[model samples]
Target chain A: LAKTTQPISMDSYEGQEVNITCSHNNIATNDYITWYQQFPSQGPRFIIQGYKTKVTNEVASLFIPADRKSSTLSLPRVSLSDTAVYYCLVQGSARQLTFGSGTQLTVLP
Target chain B: EPEVTQTPSHQVTQMGQEVILRCVPISNHLYFYWYRQILGQKVEFLVSFYNNEISEKSEIFDDQFSVERPDGSNFTLKIRSTKLEDSAMYFCASSERADTDTQYFGPGTRLTVL
Candidate 1:
């Protein structure tokens, strides 16, 4: 499993764009970067996933550069309801997904 | 938008007692998993089940812990002898496939052991 490092916390006002970057210097070829958002009392919810380049959905976008060592999760038009912990994980074909200390994103109103 | 569902949103039990956390994964999904997160700590994987057997499990899933898929829709996690440290939010997740498909997590069952 590749170890991922992310900022401990980030703050943004409502309607601002938030970009959270994760670094996995030892990412493997088969590893795909996945992001999950967890609320205070709920299970982590899948946000977006990408292997390389850029992938976008209705909620967010994932940008992976050519290096694959780092990836960014971009959230557009943030709102107070989006305040939660964001986890960036590099997962292979393995059965289990390891969760690291994620970045706590705080969206202020 | 089908989703996983867990029962007994919150459970409180005494140390050394037994507790069972139940979940109903999305229909048509084949893979099931159990994970827990201690308060103020990161989420930790416990085990993954596929084809009526455990495909993978972490050291945290020792003799005291067990998982069962007794029926078509119900997947369960049983703690034989709950300890104080066993108190945490237990989440059940299921994925369409193990290789690369995304896993969907349930709301989670909060277990408090006293």
Candidate 2:
């Protein structure tokens, strides 16, 4: 399994864009990057996933450069409801998954 | 919008007692996993079961912990001897496959050991 690093917390205001980046220096070729969001007391919800390049969905966008060492999760025009802990993970074929501390986004109004 | 379901949203048990946490995964999912999170901590993986056997597990899952798929519809985690440190929210998750598939989580069972 590949290890991942992310910031402990981030602060953003409503209507502003927020970007949280995760580093996985030992990422393997078969690893796929996936992002999940968790609100207080709720299960982590799937946000977006990407192998490389840029992938955009109705909720958020994931950007991975050619190196794939790191990836960025972009949330445009964030709202108060977007305040939550975002987890970046490398889903591997074997082993139980691992989750990091995650970047807690505080979207202050 | 099918989701994983777990029983006893919250459980309170005395130390050294036996406790069972149950889960019913999505109907189509082939892989099942158990994870736990202490309040204000990162989620930790415990075990993963597929095809009626454990495909993978973490160090956290010791002899004290066991998993079973008693019947076709239910999966369960059994703790033979609960310790004070076992107080944490246990989450049940399932994926369509054991490899390269996203796992969906349940609301979690908050276990409080005294």
Return the top candidate by TM-score: 1
Worst 10 residues of 1 chain B by lDDT: B95-104
lDDT of each: 0.96, 0.93
Residues B48-76, candidate 2: write the lDDT tens digits. 99999998889999999999999987999
Separate DockQ for every predicted complex: 0.85, 0.77
- Per-residue lDDT over A1-109 for candidate 2, one digit per residue giving the tens place of the 0 to 100 score: 7899999999999999999999999999998999999998777888988999999999999999999999999999999999999999998777577889999999999
Per-residue alpha-carbon lDDT of candidate 1 for residues A1-109, written as tens digits (9 for 90 to 100)? 7999999999999999999999999999999999999999899999999999999999999999999999999999999999999999988989799999999999998
What would you estimate as the lDDT of candidate 1?
0.96
Candidate 1 residue pairs in clash (backbone atoms < 3 Å) = none
Candidate 2 off by > 4 Å: none
True lDDT of residue B69, candidate 2: 97
Stretches off by above 4 angstroms in model 1 are none
